[model samples]
Target: MVTPCPSLGPPAPYVRRNVTHPASLSAWARLLGRYARCIRGRRRDENRKRGSGMEIHWSHVEEISEDERHAIEARLSALAAGHTDMIDLRIVGRGTGHHRHGGKEIRVACQVRGREIVAVRSADDLGLALDQAIDAFEREVRKLREIRSTHRDERPQNPPYLGIVDRVLHAAGYGFIVTDGGEKVYFHRNAVHGGLEFERLTEGDRVALNIEAGEKGLQATTVVPAPPGVPAP
Candidate 1:
């Protein structure tokens, strides 16, 4: 059996803090610091008053250092003429534009929290965008590096070329070679280096572009069989 004693004077107000680790304590300190300094008018509402999403407009990608500015311009051009419409651009650290540099009529997208521009992967690709609002150029280079590494690993020393048949619709006995992507390729009557023969070409043989793109989606410049064990070039 237990006896009921007098109640403690007003239950001590609940203290909600539950610090467990030093890192937690440090984090709490930093949060408290932010709360303390971010009082009153400007600091209090600065982050909250953004219109929708933040957008950084970088019009003067040029006018910077010759190399850096050119790099940014290259990225813009690639985006403008790339196949992928997506560019993971980020606005890591922004710099105030110069007198004749920025603050002009610029186009902006949703600005990212942190990132920068670098270089282009394949200048031959089509359908990217310019007027990029990028920050750093080096980071983009890292992306390029990763792509190259993957390409080197997956791609063969020599891949087959792709092209469209550029000859009469000869159903009987005629010859045609596919023009590789963006370039021109030669398809001799005996050029079908594959197990098949050139004479067996169909109208639209879907293939991978193993060549460079020339004026107006020109066919392959160097047409060849896709499989290995063909005669040397």
Candidate 2:
């Protein structure tokens, strides 16, 4: 019996196997174009801000005067010249007002470009981009405030707490605190602030402790054993 050579499969079907997948070079170019525009705008805004920051605007907060208008134009021009293509830049808000007829609130958008920022915009005109930028800036400011207020420690920090000695061997001079969270914090006899050695500690004994960082982990220091009837503090 004779078999077909099997080498005669259609060329079109075989060639189609290597066909290139669909891709959108033009779409990518358009998307990048839009992004580029946003970046350029940000840079221009930055330059305007730098220039405006150097010169004072109108003394009155209520309005923008002729001098301020010229200043704003010059700053914008400077930005156009220096920063034709740039990306996300810093903006420091400078002023705020309402649109005519109190239609909407406006916040000044200032950013740095080149040697200085020359960009300026009313927040109302900046759209969602400006809103996000302001929110991010405010978030950073809040975090900084928190960092400044709290005590930063090179070592780990934990909350001070009150506990009760669940068990202690007077001879061993060591005990464990049953924390309010039901966690046990190991303590040595020397941890007692009163310098009085416990005769014998047992379960349900109340105590006060200042949580401390230890070699292993969090431990209790300045322990004060409480009498049977009183709660640990």
Candidate 3:
């Protein structure tokens, strides 16, 4: 025979039962359905926000064909390849004037880096107008890129002042380098490197010059051909 163990403080209190009225149950079911729907809607909105990374706005002249729109999108994507920021494209089409022969106008504005680059064109034919506008837009984008590249903050390994060969006195073996900054520095034929000769240099020739203070003043100690591809000052 086995002895029964003593109860631990009688039996613990019974578990609480979840009791609800019919009306309450219905209200809870409805509340749960609404919550689920809200969750689904929020998810959809998030997905859409992710998918539409670029914001493109289109307006009247109704002249842009589907194919042309696609082409424009492709071009813009190429322009925005390296940029992770949002790109906004606003395109407008309208008549240049109210006159009978007034040409159509297509205007495109690209928002980049907190600046707006706008291109506009008017043509007798709608397609021609669109083409011209796109060309102009591309040119604007290219110009912006060039400006940014030139003004970028990165330091180069061997930075040199950009200048032009203003004057050359072959006999004296000395010449002046007129920097884009409008300052002039003196250089001698011996200072030119890379097989460059004072005799071969002409006025308005682009060059990169390294300057230092000499007994006379700031002098170009070294000069070369704008480092091959760099622009003159």
Candidate 4:
């Protein structure tokens, strides 16, 4: 019997493999475009989440002109530049009289790490109100900066406190000292002149301590035995 060569069975019936698909380029391009879009969207979301370093929001100022808004923003930015710790400002302006007759009142608030600062002002006109409020806010910001700078400068210049060790917890590695002013200040073993010396401390031992503000209250930055013959103050 004569058999066919069997090289192929009816040309494989055009099963349409991926390599033979006409839409492959377009499909790949669509996928790449979608990926790009996804990447761009993620970046945009990240940028929004991070936000600009400092921000200002407004309320009830829509009645004011654009130029006025720009002026107010610029003034506030100038005020904030001096205080690096200041972030997030909000400005609000309200009309006191019906039909915008009497005057405008403005309030400005800013945020710091641990506190909020605010200023308020009023005037017969929107421009004047904004100007006065921003000026007051600037002064407040300046005063805050000066006060903090002064506090930091005073810390090292101030003399160490004179005290007597009123209590000691050898097991806990901590102690307390009574200042000459009768205030009890806390001290940890780390604050001692040497950890080994802290072990020798007794309830009545005299100590000289450098006082500082702590989360729980007054504490000693340095704790050392008082010099011989020095009276506890």
Query: What lDDT does each candidate get?
Result: 0.38, 0.49, 0.71, 0.70
Residues 100-119 of candidate 3: C-alpha lDDT, one tens digit per residue: 64478888886544456788
lDDT per residue as tens, model 1, 62-149: 4334355345445433433312112223322223343344433222332111122333221111111222334223345445556756
Best by lDDT: 3
Alpha-carbon shift of residue 79 in model 4 (angstroms): 2.2
Please provide TM-scores, in order, for all candidate models, with all chains considered together.
Answer: 0.23, 0.28, 0.41, 0.42
Poorest 10 consecutive residues by lDDT, candidate 3: 44-53
Total residue pair clashes for candidate 4: 1
In candidate 2, position 42 carries an lDDT of 61
Model 4 alpha-carbon drift over 4 Å, by segment: 1-52, 98-102, 155-233
Cα displacement (angstroms), candidate 4, residue 95, comes to 2.0
Candidate 1 vs candidate 3, TM-score winner: 3
Model 3 residue 188 distance off true place after TM-score fit, in angstroms? 53
Please give the clash total of every predicted structure, in order: 21, 18, 1, 1
What's the candidate order when arranged by decreasing TM-score?
4, 3, 2, 1
Better of 2 and 3 by TM-score: 3
